[model samples]
Target chain A: MKKSSGDNWDSLEKNWREKLDSHKEEVPAAIWNQIEKKLDEKKGKAVPFIIHRRQWSWAAVLLISFGVGWWQLSNPNALVDDSKMANHIQTEINAPVQHLPNTSTPELEEISSSTNPNVVSHSEPMPSHDIHSNLNQEPRNTTESIPVIEESKPNTNPVILADNRTFEKEKPASLAKEESVEMLIDIQPSQANNQEKENSYVPEPSKKRHSLFARVVKQLRQAIDGEPVDWQTLKQGDPKLENSIHQVANTYIKTEQVVQRTFQF
Target chain B: MSKTLLPFKSEQELIQACQKQDRRAQQIVYQVNAGKMMAVCKRYLGVGPDAEDALMEGFMKVFSKIDNFQGQGSFEGWIRKIMVNESLMKIRKTANRYDQDINETYDIAHPEDAIMHLGVEEIQNLILELPPGYRTIFNLYAIEGYSHIEIGDMLQISEGTSKSQLSRARQLLQSKLKELQA
Candidate 1:
């Protein structure tokens, strides 16, 4: 038996090592040819493993980033920054409110004036608190079909409105009559109601009660017509009220009955 | 026409070109290491298509993974390790075919003078004559310089089996040496 440490065993390993260290057989040319072909095939097929691994990592990172961005967009209010939210609320509070003219239909004016013809009808601009101005702008062009007084002829008979009220052509010379001036009628509801209101008017409470009813009716009209009540014109009468009332009405009021109820007070 | 006319002056330059996947540099790398790697493969598997396959596969790995070589060791040593691993993989499938009983002993003769006189080809032939299991253990122990414990980890066998296989391989090789001398 050959002991592992025996000289013969040691010599056997040593000789094999010394001889084979310098001994190299010739590799066949076909092997290199095959290897070259395989390298080419591999090059054509894919990138190196390191680059492949890098690309996958980048793809994963991009996918995660996109997922986070999509989540943020889908739930926009969930991550509102406190400072930005405060800035937005402050801006809204400081912004001035805008409004449109509170205009009413000529039909309501004709009814009031015909019932109380002795009520003086003038072309002067109506007051902001004028009950007729409490109604929203009438259904657009409801007054266009109404005949307007001719500015050229001062002596012409007052144009008869839908309510049979005469629209007097008296004018202040400085006020220019615009072709599309919106009309506002000032007429007593009826001789009896006007007398009663004049007698029992308790200035503050009566005016407040009347305004509250007008506001409620305006809201209902707005709800039904899908139009906002032009409260600015309610606070400040139509800026162009001094001009001609002959211009075709621009805005709409859907319910004539609502307009009638609004000013009946 | 010869496809490879190597312009790289140093091994580092060749390795860099291979990292860049230059075909001529790859060919030069294959040409330079193929013969020694084939000899290493043959020591384990003998001269056959299996050795050729191992040689081709080892070079393929070298080119594809060239970027991993960070100048830590000799390039040839790294390649030799790859070739050895490829051979071991080819051997693992048929490992059960030649597993003899450890108790089956051979009377090892004193063939020190004969082993000393043998040429490289004769020593290689002697190792090839061993059973596949014995041949693997002997080549790992003798030529590759792996300890039996390392061999056990590599081949997934017990240290005792590695030692027994190596001892049996040496006894059989010594008997062959004595017969050759006669």
Candidate 2:
């Protein structure tokens, strides 16, 4: 048996190429069905323009957050700053009052003398005595006159109850009484009315402060209990009020610490 | 005659319609070329469902990448190339297990009458009977007219390896022809 040479292999290769090149087979009809089915499957897979499930979830979350933010902005109940309301009332009280054209200076003097014997008796002409006498005599007229005094010298009308108490507490006994009387004279009728209304609505200031401290403690407890507080929403209003609340919170914390130390002792 | 007389779209028109994803035009293109493409796939994959799988995959690729055909070559050549590539890929994946070393020096007995009597189907079956490695190189080099260099690049074998494989394939086929004659 002879081994084929390279030339013989070339001839065989040529013959093989000619044979295979001329050959044509019918593709099975079922192949087209398979291909069409595959194409259809591919098309089905590709056609869905739906966002990913996670992306859709994220979009829904964002939409919900925006809706909640918008609702919070629109809701009047959401704007519950007690201190802002108090400041607004004080501003109204401190505003200048228009005196009636018919009420002359002589009439004012006569009214002052008749209604307020204390004012006439006070020879030194103390502003506090004049105001106190007028308050005692006629509440309506006192309301009108106080704004006049406020307009004349605004700082002299120092009617902040907290300030008076702190000032008296820190001062000598004699100076404390005089300063306390002066501070009382500074209380405009409108401010007194507002304070009364607030007092009626909530508890007295001491009780309210205690309740606030209790609420803060409860919030701290809840936070320790693993509930999250949205401090961002709580700190939305006036900076001054935020500062005062922060101070009160610190004071309450200090008082709690002192009590804790006393108990330990 | 009547089918020929019926208005048939030019190859360009069919291609354009296929690009637009027109199903009718795509079907028409498939009908025209699928037999030849199947034959090409059958050469590499042999006569079976594997050939059908390769053909189907090839056609799908054709449709998917129809935009890449820049009207430079004959559409049939473009389609034929895709079918060939698909067949090669399928063979590479399935044929890795059959990577036996080639026997270079086989005894050759020329059986001209037997070789001549064998129909194209018999020859194809004989080619399929060759080891997958030999069959692939044989198809690429001899039948497909790819240079040994091209076959090497396509199959990732060296050029000398492709030449040796082709020789081994021819010897195997000749021996098969002699056996059929005997």
Candidate 3:
């Protein structure tokens, strides 16, 4: 009888396994040498690629650090010291209200520019409207001759804080009242200085109430003329001043809207 | 100026040394396995640079991954599997040659006597003459003792395809054995 299927296949498989598995062919010795050289090459290539990636990572980190440092330095208020800012606000609240000197618009510009070097004078075209007629009557200052308001601190050189962009929000109500009072004092000099007649005479405070309204009006006019405004005080002040302030503010807004519409066309 | 080399005390010690990338241990391991691995490569790739290349690549893998061996089964078995896989990879690179159809067929019968009479190289040469697909399937199934399922997985073919290729290989080998016997 023929052997079972399993037995027959097993014998054949067994015979081949015995012959081939035990068999050993001679391997050229040079093949091992080739393997060693290739392994070395792979190690050589791998090390540098990892180091190169690490170097790139370090470079990226340093570049980002340098960029952040440069940005903070260029932006003056980026590293604002809270204590110094509080001190500046305190100084503005306590500072005495000085009278505007008897001087011309050019003289005011000269005084402002002489007082603060950080102030950048930029003369934007003022919109022609009834609201700004008072400002229009005055001689327009050239781009280089316009005055920027600076932080009026004693002893230290006055620096243009309003132009720093954070001045309006951080400025207290007392500071706004003082700036409005001081602006009126500055503008009244042109008319009052003529009464003085002597160029050498210094200006003194007049017991005049109309100068307050003029101060508020001129502040609104200055805002419409592209100077920065302390809108915080105007919006959030005592309700008693709101009516007069809002009426003038509305006129300024309407004039600005008309100007924008004119420019769009 | 050369340094003296010491032989490993035992197989475990030898494996540990190879794991540490000891050059002497690596050379000794290569010397022991190279002949058997070369034989396995020649069976799949035949006697040429392809066979030699597979042998070199296989040994390199064995050394590189020696730490992973973990004393699992026989070390020689582990190395032989690597050599076989390396040869298969070389076959796959040529791809077209490895899947060719051997159209000729013969009856399924035992050639136990002829296999017994033939020398090792003669039987090897006979297996080598089969098409790459047939040869690979035959070596994997008959000599390597792999199931048709295992062969299919190894060569990325279906079990049925592996069976058919193995059948064709056996028929061709039997015919060749008869021709030699005649």
Best by TM-score: 3
Off by over 4 Å in 3: A4-6, A46-61, A74-77, A80-265, B1-6, B97-107, B112-114
- Winner on DockQ between 1 and 3 is 3
Clashing pairs in 1: A110-A163, A111-A163, A138-A252, A138-A253, A139-A252, A139-A253, A140-A252, A179-A247, A180-A247, A181-A247
**Candidate 3 lDDT, A69-121, residue by residue in tens:** 44434543422332234434555664554323221144334444455444322
Docking class of 2: acceptable
Chain B TM-score against the true chain B, candidate 3: 0.90
lDDT of 2 by residue, A1-265 (tens): 6544655656666876787765678877888788788778877775552434435444543444344345434543332444556555655664433323232244334444454343332112345655665557644433332323323334443221122333344444544434434443556777777765764333234543444334544555454356985433434443433544454345445654554455345
Q: Which stretches of candidate 1 lie over 4 Å from their true place?
A: A1-5, A47-265, B1-6, B97-108
Best by lDDT: 3
Descending-lDDT candidate ranking: 3, 2, 1
lDDT of 1 by residue, B107-152 (tens): 5556655458777787788889998888998888889889978988
TM-score of each: 0.50, 0.49, 0.54
Clashes of each: 10, 0, 1
Interface RMSD of 1: 2.1
lDDT of 1 by residue, A1-265 (tens): 6454456676768777877866788888888788878877886666575466546544543444344345434544322332234434544554332111122234434444565442223343334344233234353232332333334334533332222222223222232222112222222246435544554323233443245335434543464456865544433352222111111011112233343344343
